[model samples]
Target: MLSTRRRQFVNMLIFLLLILFILYSSILARFRTPEVALDSSSGSFLTKTYLGLENEQAQSELISGSSLHNEGQFVSGNPQSSLSSLSSSSNEPETINKVSTAGVPSDDVNNRNHISAEISSERSVLKSEKKNEVEEELHRILSISPVVIFSKTRCPFSVRAKNILLKKYSIDPAPHIVELDQHPLGSSLQKSLAALTGRSSVPNVFISGQSIGGCDEVIDLDQKNILATKIYELGKQSIKVQLRQTT
Candidate 1:
């Protein structure tokens, strides 16, 4: 009584329903089987074991033998046992504890050595800097003439020395009178002069490329009539004349 197309559509719907019923029955049958679940559990266990072995190999390659022991204990969920094993494998527990305590002294010694080395390196650098400064100062001092007197304005000894040089020899020690107290480079100049002369006294006197000592020393040399003679002799031995002739 139905047309051909309608008959075909009805048949197709029946086939689909039958297929779905078969799939539902198969699912129920699978759930009912305890053996199927056991098989799945076994497969999962095998996969986990295979992956665990690969991970173990990778870990072993990364960590050292002693460290591997700790890793294994951790992976096995027995940290207490791992630490106990590490301690027990060594000497007696008290001796092991003593050795651990003794490590502090060695660490202290190492730190001290490092500090000492740093101090030594700093000292070496300071020495080099001081040497360079001294050399530069010496070069500057020798290059000039006409009595370069490095003195402090506030110093009585410096004032006395300047008066004596001006009054006695008719020599105006100006234009070269480096008044240290008034100048910004006062402290540094004083320190350098002291270092060079090997004397901590003030009023460092230089006349014709020669160190004429402090105020008292200069006065004594002048009184003894040796100052003028020394100055004249130094003038003849002029560094400027020598350099000019060489050029």
Candidate 2:
């Protein structure tokens, strides 16, 4: 009966020991849970920080890309964006100067074209008016005297004609001589005279506002003795008109 009691006591002691061991294991598991949770929280914080850094880097890239676009450039995923930015900064002034210079030349060219157009218009107007001026002037000079001689002083034919009319002939009124070579509108006058009388030379002789001929005709008339008679008749007519005006 003692042996049986001792065996039951041993079994009871083993059961109590097992219970204490189980309580100790449960306490250790509870303590280790906090450390595991702290480790997990720390890992989560690290991941969040890494994600924040990535977000900041992405935002920075977007801002830089926008700024580059504003500067008149486009770069997508290019490694040389920094170099491109520096080059753009360096060339910005040159580009501005080129644009300004280009604009100024266009303005200058437009101004020059405007001035040229005005000058051309004025020249055309003057050309049209010159014909009338020459014609009117010729008529005025022709009416200055009854007998007119259109001549140049340097012309040999004119010198011969003047010697015959001025030195050899004597009349009541003198012949009005024009030195076309010394005249301001000499060339235009010569052209008009040629168109009117069909003669383009000096020593053109006119009688009573009518072109008789040139030096050859006058020499022929003087040699034929008809020049003196013609002069006397015209002189008498002019004197009679003057006398009537006076009366």
lDDT leader: 2
> Which residue segments of model 1 deviate by more than 4 Å?
1-112, 167-175, 180-198, 221-226, 237-247
Q: Pick the candidate with the highest TM-score.
A: 2
lDDT per residue, candidate 1, 186-233, as tens digits? 666677777767766678877665677889987897788776666556
For candidate 2, which ten residues in a row score worst on lDDT? 238-247
- Candidate 1, backbone clash total: 0
Candidate 1 to truth, TM: 0.44
- Hey, what RMSD does candidate 2 come out at? 19.1
Question: Model 2 residue 176 lDDT?
Answer: 83
Estimated TM-score for each candidate: 0.44, 0.48
